[model samples]
Each structure stands twice: as C-alpha cells, then as structure tokens.
Target: MRFSRGAAMVALALMCLPGLSMAADIDGGSLSWAWGIPFAGILLSIALMPLLTPSFWHHHFGKVAAAWTLAFFLPFAAVFGPAVAGSSLVHAMLAEYIPFIILLVALYTVAGGIFIRGNLHGSPAVNVAILAIGTALASFMGTTGASMLMIRPLIRANDNRAHKAHVVVFFIFLVSNAGGSLTPLGDPPLFLGFLKGVDFFWTVRHIFPETLFLVGSLLGIFYLLDRWYYAKEGVLPVDPTPDTRGIGFDGAVNFWLLAAVVGLVLFSGFWKTPLGITIFGTEVGLPGLVRDAGLVAVTFISLRLTPASVHTDNQFSWGPMQEVAKLFAGIFLTIIPVIAMLKAGAAGPFGAIVSAVTRPDGEPDPAMYFWATGALSSFLDNAPTYLVFFNTAGGDPATLMTTLAPTLAAISAGAVFMGANSYIGNAPNMMVKAVAEERGVAMPSFFGYMAWSGAVLIPLFVIMTFIWFR
Candidate 1:
C-alpha cells in the first residue's frame, strides 16, 4: 500500500512538471577531429572493460557496473571526440567541480561517524522520524556526520534485535543519498551547483518531488523487507550489561566553527571573486590552505567538544573514514587524465548528441546538453560532471534562454538528480557502504547495489526523465 501510494504520487507529480515556456531550436554542428578523438576514447574505455575486471568480476557487481559505464561512455566519447578535448572546457571543470568533490570527501572523513538515539522497537513513528530527520541532518553536516551520529543509536535501538541490517540498508538509500539532494549544502554535487550560480532554493524546491518519491517508495519497500526479516529472526534483546549513562551535553554543536568551514567552502566555490580572502596575510583559494584550514578548525572543534567518553562508548576510530578518503583520493587522481581528455572535447561530443535528435524547427535539440551531461554524470564525479554540462549548456550561443539562469537550473537538475543512477556516481555511495560495513551490515556488492536501484531507483528516474527533462 505504501509503495502504491508513493508511486502514484510520483506519477502524478510527473504529470505536472514545468513545461518549457518558450521554444528555441538549435541544430547540428560541422565535424572536427577534436570531437572524433574523445568519442573514440569512450569506445576504447568500453572495449577495455574486460581488462579492468578482477577474477571475481561476476560476483563483484560494482566493478562490473563501472566497466559497463566505461563501455557505454568510452564508445560514445570516441565518436564525439571533438567534444572531449577543449582546454577551456577542461579548465572550467577543474576550477569549478574538482575542488568541490575534494572538499566533500574530506569533510566526510573528518566528521567521523554519526550516532543515532533510541531503540528500533520504541515506536514505529519514532523510527520514521529518526530516519527522516537523520537523513535531512546528513545533507548539511555531510552524510557521514548523519550516518555516524545515527547508526549507533539505531543499532542500539535494535541492539536486542536480529533483523537490524535491513534498517541500516534503507537508511543508506534514504538518509545517505536521496535525502541530501535538496541542498548543495546537503549534497556535494548540488553544493557545487550552488557555487556555480544555481539558486540554493531552486534545487530544494525542484528536487522535492524526486527526493520524496524515491525515498518514500524505498522506505515502503524497506518496511516490508524489515517485516519479513522480523518474522524470521527474533529481536536480540538489549544486553543485560548494556551501558546506561545519562546523555551528556552532546555539546559538539560549535556552530561558529562549522559555519566558518562552510563559509570557506562557499568562497572556494567562487574562487574567482573578491569573496576569496587571505588569513594572516596568506591567500586562501580553492583547494588551498584556507579551505583546508577551515576544515581543520571544524575537525578540532568536533573532536574537542565531543565527550571523550563518547568516543570510547561509540567505539569510534578513524579507520573507516580514512579508508574512504584514501580510496577516493586514488580514484579522483587516476581519473584526472581521463576526465581531462573528455573535458577538452566537451562541446563537440555534446554536439553529436544534439545532431542525433531532430528539433521541431529543424533546429538542433536544446536537450542534447541535458542528456549528454546527465549520461556523463552517472559515471564521473557528479560535481565535475555537472560543471561540464552546465558550462556546455551555458556556452551554446544559440540557446534561447536570455540569461544563464534557466540553463543553469536544467544542468544542475540533471547532474545532481541523475547522479544516483549508479553506486560510483557519487561519493556518498562509497561512504555509506563503508559505514554500513563498520556497522556489520553486509551491503550488496556493486552490481548488487545496482540491482536494488534497478528495481527501485531506475523506474523513478524514468518517470522523472519523461516528466521533467523530456
């Protein structure tokens, strides 16, 4: 019943999506070598997918999914080589998106784990509230913050229970990912968009439907799954020797410190502006000491303000977040050469997508940018992926929009929204998996996560595509 209702709501929401107020048709571009090179690159990546695999490729769905994405984009990028290698495009991407992704990954690692309160059996309503509030909190503090803050409380809530992993999994799907879509402050990609001229309120308002539908439906499915596990596995009662201590100040709320870090992040996002400042006679720029300094300050405050006993009580260690940092740092670095090449040809490759679609005025399709950008985001770091598309959309001289604003919104909506298509699409997916593992929830392998998304997320996106983007 919950699924049906949520799906119905999603379908209805689609029926009323904002239609284009004015139509401007722009058409095909003449071919160039720049376009061809990148298109070939995409194809070659796809062809080499087999070589990138491990012996356990079949079992490791995540690797398989990555290979599949490489396959699709590599071929596509090859055919659109001109679009893949423009220096201007590459520069913009680096200046805009890269630092943003780096900041988010760093923040997640520093915030450590979130701790949840209350047991699972206290009240069904309370459980929902925790999930809802916790997820919302995650978008702001970084998903790791919310995850770290709530996971233990949730575990403790279900401490005497056997069917708890299911709760954590749904929590991953909802609070960790979907819930953060509304604010750039909420998710790295959206936040990048915010830095790039996307109105903060715009993403929040427009994305509400997407977030609500996906989360509500997933939660509904989770409830049913939870019931099945509950029936089969009895609750593990609270430990007789459970540690019961009074709740201390939970005083870690050093608002000014966190705000300072966020302010620095925002300034970094607009690195070209005077808003960029120097502290102690030193300039603080994107990916520079100033930004790192802010993060350092917040980390110190969060650590110092948190009760020493809380760390002991939570069994907290920096290992899991550290691992995420190390792994993603490698990923971000290795992919630089690849992303650089693709970015160089951003325009020409995207032009190829435009050529494929016929416009009503025989004008090239305005939407080619949306699809190309969206398609790329599902594979690359969504923040940079978004900037690539946003720049492309804004760069087109023929685009009818009088200002960059609408195009920015469309680009942002596509990049931030579509990024959820696969596990590797965003940083949070990796973080969630790591946190889940720490909590002892055996999450689905990469492909397994996709299977779940395929079952739930994909259809919802399809509806969104037709209703919002199409």
Candidate 2:
C-alpha cells in the first residue's frame, strides 16, 4: 500500500512538471538564503528522524520527504508563478533525477541478482581481502554497484564476529566512496565532469594518486581494526550457513546484464545525437533516451534470467531502491534553488562561497577548492556540487586540464571522498546503511556515522591536503 502511494506521488510530480518558466531567466542573485530552508529541513529530517523516532521515520519518511518538497514548490509557485515553478520542476526531473535513479536501479538490481553462494570464515585477512577487492571493483562497476555486490558477502563473512559495525563503516570509506575516485564510471561527480568535456582519462591521470592515498590508507586502518577485533573474539559462533562448498557465484547471467548496463552508460557518453524529442517541456536526447531504455531492458533481463533462488539468497527486495527513489524525488526538487544560487557564483547570494575558493592574489586555491567542494558535497548531492566547483574553476576543459589541473583534481577528490561524511552525501552510503541495518548490523545514526567519518576521514583529508593539494 505504501509503495503504491509513493508510486502515485512520484507519478503525479513527474506528470505535473512542465517546462519554460521563470527559472530560465531568473538569476540566482535574486534568490535568498531562505530559499534553501526546505532542502535543509529534509536533510535534517533524514538525519534526526531516524535517531529520534525510528518507528515514525520508518513509517512516514516518504510523507515527510514529500511534504518538504511541497514546502518549496508551493511557495515558489505562489511567489514566482506556476511557470517558473514548473520549469524548475521539469528541469530537475528530466535532467538530473530520472537518469540518476535509472542508473542506481539498474546497478542495484543487476548486482543484487548475482549473490555469492557460500560464505568464508571471517578472519582479519579474509575481511581485508574482501574490502580490497570491493575497493578495486568500485572503479569499474561504480561505488554503488561494487557496494551492493560485495556488501552482503562481507556481512555474511563477518556475521560471527563480535565487532562488526566497523567493517561496514570502513566499507563505506573504502568501497562506497574513495575507491570510486579513479574513474568517471566509478563515481557520479567525475562522471558528470566527463559529460561536461572533461577528458575520459582526466580523473585517472590526476585524481588516481589521491584515490590511491585515501583508499590505501583506509585499507591499512581497517586491517588493523579488524585484526584487533578478531583477536578479541577468541571463539566463533557456529556458522549458521557455513561454507558447505567452495565459493561460487549463483547468477552468472546477470553479470552480462550488468555489462550491458555499463555499455549503455558509456554509449550515451561517447555517442551524441542531434535528434531529440520534447517531453513535457524537457528536451530528451535520443542517445540518453535509448540508453535509459536499454537500462530498463537490462533490468528486466536480469530479473528474467536470474533464478528466484538467487534473489532469495541475496535477500533482495525492492524496498531499499524505492525508498531512495521517493526521498530523492523530494531532494532533487527542493534543491533547485540552491543549485541555481551556486551557479550564480559571485553575482549570487552565495558569492562568498565562490570568493572563498580564490586567494586574494586571484589564483584558484586547490586546497580551499578541495575543502569547500567537499564541505558542500558532504551535505548536498556531490555530482552537482562538483559541477559548481568545476564551473567556478572556469569550466574550460583545456585550461582546467593544464593550468588549473590541481583544482579539478581537488574538486574530483573532494566530491568523491567527503561523500562518506554523511549518508545522504551519496546514494550508496544510505543504501549500505539501510541494508546493513536490515541484516541485523546495528548501523550508526546519520550523525553517529558522521562522528566516525569525522574522526577517521577528516584527518586523512587534512594530511592529503598538505601532501598533494598544497
């Protein structure tokens, strides 16, 4: 019933979205800080509601998300008129939200279908190995994809351990965030840069060093932590679903389907088309439309070919993806003003932010870019946060590639790495948290998780600044 209701709400929002409005002409200069209140409210709701009242948050999170979205839209419509409101709504949905959810769903569905059949005995070495593999895989299949694929197995492997929260916590650090810094395919922020004419190899060439530093350091820290925990747990619980046989995969076909999804994503990036169709005032490109269609088909193919037993083994359900879809619907909508304000740069209300990225000498400071980009990405969606900084750094691929290279690299690294600071910072962080909680691992609250990342990640970032960005 809740799913149906959420579906209806989403459908109505999409349908009501119309194009051409005050949003197109209105500069972010006119918008005030107050416009960002709804967005802040929703994120705060996400952070506090779970800790303060889990049952209420669990039951009506969708409603709360929707209400916050309406809080922005209703007032904006009244003040700016329906056309401006509709234009922002249409633009956000067509340009950002749809593609974002499509990619997440396809990856989640395909990865979830392929489950590891048998679990290994949890040892410090074994746990570190899994984290390392997942970290590496993240650069290829995406942080979200690698996380969904590896997290369940890791959880099962460590199920008998006395201390397990730290495992999932470190997984978010290494696998779900930092490991994705090396490639556009690995993380959305870099991928957005790629679509904006940043070279395919740009991230690999520049950000790879930072990625290695962060990922390598985190892995070492995790190993030490896991080793200590293993020594403390002198005895193991009888493995309920022990490895009866050697490790093997259950749904091999879904991997091909996953490959197809990846191919479609790449195809859209490389293949541009002049042909486009207008849907509800939004311009839809043929390449993007086809790619989304192909992804939807790949999702169905994964479902059809993969056995029911496979999904059952993975304990797969649509709940987590749906929750993301509904909540992000609200987020994407409410964030329109904030994005516009940032885009306004020095002319806009957030001019201080733009000014802060530059030194008095007029050179763009890479360290400040890293910290500022990271600070915003820690709260807002990292993809757009990256674009804001990328544009602030001149938005020229050639110049940014050569002259302002460190700035771009810092932006890329900050967007990907600091996303681990909060669950809502990246979609996968929340997904991992939700899944771990579902599996009986008591994941930390949103703020609690921040405490962990604040303690562990911030110092590393500071060290990285002195080592590289400086």
Candidate 3:
C-alpha cells in the first residue's frame, strides 16, 4: 500500500508535466527573480525538513517533492504557456535528469550487492587504513558505493569501542566527499560536468593536487583525533562482532560490473557520433543511448546474479535510491528557470551573484568561486548547485576547461570537497550517519556535525584557497 501510494503520487505528478512540443525558449534576461523561488524552496526543504520534522519528511518527502514540481510547472505553464514549459521539461528530462539517475541507479545497485564479510578490531591505525582504502575506492566505485561497501565493516570493526563516532565522521569526510574528487564516477557533480562536455579525465587531471591535499589532511587529522579517543576509551574486552571467518567479499563479481560501468562511461565520452534522434528540443546521441542502456542492463544483471545472502548481509534496500530519485526529479525540474537565468549572466536577475564572483578586470575570481560554490554546496544538493555555478561561470565546458581553468577547478573542488560540511550536503553523508546510528553509534546532530566540519574542514579549505585557488 505504501509503495503504491508513492508510485501513484509520482505518476500523478508526471501526468502534470509539460507537453512534448517544442515552443519558445525561456529568456532568462527577462525572467523575474521570483522564478527562482521554487528551486530555493525545494532545496531548503531537503536541507531542513529532515532535521526539523523527520517523521513528516520521511513519510511525505516524495509528496513534498511532487508538490514543488507542481509549483514550478503550474506557474511556468500559466505564464509561459504549456508548450514552452513542456519544451523546457523535456530538455531537462532527456538531456540531464535521465542520464544522471541511470548512472546512480547502476552504481547503487552494483555497490549494494557486494557484502564485505567478517571484521577486524578498530585500532586507530586499522580505522585509518579502512578510511584510506575506502577513500581510494571512492574514485573508482563512487562515494556512495565505497561508503555502502565499507561503512558496515568499519562500524563492525569499531563496534566494541566506546568512542567510535569520530571514526564514522572521518569516514564521511574522506570517503563520502573528498575522495570522490578524482573522477566523474566518484561524484554526481563531476558526472553532471561530464554530461555537459567536460572530458572524462579532466577532473583528475586538474584537481588531483587538491584532492591529495584535502584527503591526506583529513586522514592525518582523523588519525590524531581517533588516536586520542582510542587511548581515552579503550575497547571492550570482548569484540562485539568477533571474526567468524576470514575477511573476504561476497558477490565479488560486482567488481567486474563496476569496471564495466567505468568502461561504458568512458566509451560514451570518447565515441563521437553524428547519428542520433531528437526528443523535443534535445538531441539524443547514439553514444549516450548506448551508455544509458548499458547502465540499465548492468543494474539488472547485478540484481539477477548477486546471491540473496549477500544482499541480506549487506542490508540492501531500494529505499535510499528511491528517495534520491524522487527528490532529484523535483530538483532537476525546478532548476530549469534558475539555470536559464544564470545563463543570462549579469543581465539576469542574479546579476549580483555574477558580480560577486567577478574581478574588477572582468574575469572570474577563482577564490570567490570556490567559496561561493562551497558555501551553498554545504547546504543545498551539490549536484544542482554545481549546475547553477557551472552556468553562472558561463556554461561552456570548453572555455571553462581552458581559458578559465582555475575558475572551473575551484568550482569543481568546492562542490565535491566541501560537501562534507553537513549531513545534508551530500547524499552519502546522511546514509553513513543513518547506518552508524542503526548500529548504536551516537552520531552527532546536524548542527553538531557542522561544528565538526567547521573546526576541521574549514581550516583545510582555507589553506587550499591560498595554495590553489589563489
């Protein structure tokens, strides 16, 4: 009954979506600031509702998302006509949202199938090693994948310790956010950048230095803090989850599936094709279609091949993926006008934003871009916030990659790295928190986590600004 209600709500919302015909393009230069209200509202709701009204948000988040989608669609159709609104909706869905969700689904499914069996004691060194390994895996398998795959073992390893919450906090910092900086597959914002024409290896090539610095600094800090805690509150005499078997992987075949996902993503980026179809105003390329279809196949294949015991051991469920899909559906829809207005640059309603990140010489300030993108990414969903800033910095991937390389690097680094600032900042942050709490670890409250980030992450980001963004 619950599933049906949620599905029905999503279906009803889809029914209200704009028509399929292409119409007049939105003139961001002419759009009023009010057009951005729905975008802000939805993001704010995602950030606040879970903290303030957990039960209501948990039960009705999909409904709230749908409501915001309607808020944008109804007003848009009324003011701009259904044809115009439909074109925008189609463009967003076909060009951006579908591809984004498909990749996440593939990653989530493949990652969820692989269960890490057995556990080890959580000495400070062992915890740091787990964090470092998870951090490295994050670049290849995704932050979500690495987090889901590694969080359990880390928790189990530390289950006997009295002061284990800091271990999980560092896991969120290094594995869930900063470590994903090296690859597009590692983070949603980078994937979005890839979808926008940034080269497959562009992020790694540009931000490797920044990633190494942030991740290394985080690991070092976590080690010192964890060492103190370990000494202060020694482990219980008996391990809570003593090793029952040698540490090994269940559903290890998914590693190959993970490799295939990386291959498909790379193939799509490199394989140029003139053959394509048009959907509404957006062109659907052969490479993209192949990529998306292959990803869907990978998702199902993982589900079919993985043993039920592995999934059970992993506590795998579709709940997190479902919530993300529904929430981002609204985010993609509402962000249409915001992206449009941002594309209009200084002449648009968000001219102040443009000016704030601009230098007196009419160029972008990399430091300002870093801080601005990071500040909001700390609060809003980083993926869409990335798109917003990507457009704000003049949305041409080629130009941003070359002439404004520093600006683009700042934006990328900020969006991916500072997402560690809050639980709501990145998807995996909350997931890791929930998993830790489920295991009886007393994870900090939302603001308390912020206190951790502010004390630790903020100083690191400042040093990064001077060394790199400057």
TM-score against truth, every candidate: 0.67, 0.96, 0.89
Give the top-scoring candidate (TM-score): 2
Distance from true position, residue 142, model 1, in Å? Answer: 3.8
Predicted candidate 1 versus true structure: per-residue lDDT over 1-470, tens digit per residue: 22223323432442333331122111123333342343344334323433466344323433333343344334443554323322222222234333444465445534442232222452344456667777778667655456656665665556556555556656766666666776767667676666555555766665576567767877677666666676677655545225545433233453444556567766655566454543222234544546766676667666766666556656676555544443343344334444444444425434454344335565334355455666776666676676555554444423422344444545655565556655566666666666666667666665666676677666766666665555
List model 3 lDDT by residue over 1-470, tens digit each. Answer: 24334434543454465664454588998998898888889877876787899899979988888888888888888888767777777777777778877887888889888888887889999998999999999987889879887888898889899888889999999999998998888888998898789987999999999999888888889888989998899989888675776878999999999899889987887787799888666788999999999999999999999999998887777777777677767777888888787667779987777678989988899999999889878866788778888988889999999999999999999999999998868878877886677678998877788899999999999999999999
**Per-residue lDDT value at 180 in model 2:** 89
Order of the predicted models by lDDT, top scorer first: 2, 3, 1
Model 2 pairs whose backbones collide: 22-84
Give the worst 10-residue stretch by lDDT in candidate 1.
19-28
- Kindly provide the TM-score of model 2 when superposed on the true structure, using C-alpha atoms: 0.96
Full candidate order by TM-score, most accurate first: 2, 3, 1
TM-score: model 1 vs. ground truth: 0.67
TM-score-wise, the better of 1 and 2 is: 2
lDDT of 1: 0.52
Most accurate candidate by lDDT: 2
- In Å, residue 196's CA in model 2 sits off its true spot by 1.0
Candidate 3 Cα outliers beyond 4 Å, as residue runs? 1-19, 192-202, 236-238, 384-403, 437-442
- Comparing 1 and 3 by lDDT, which wins? 3
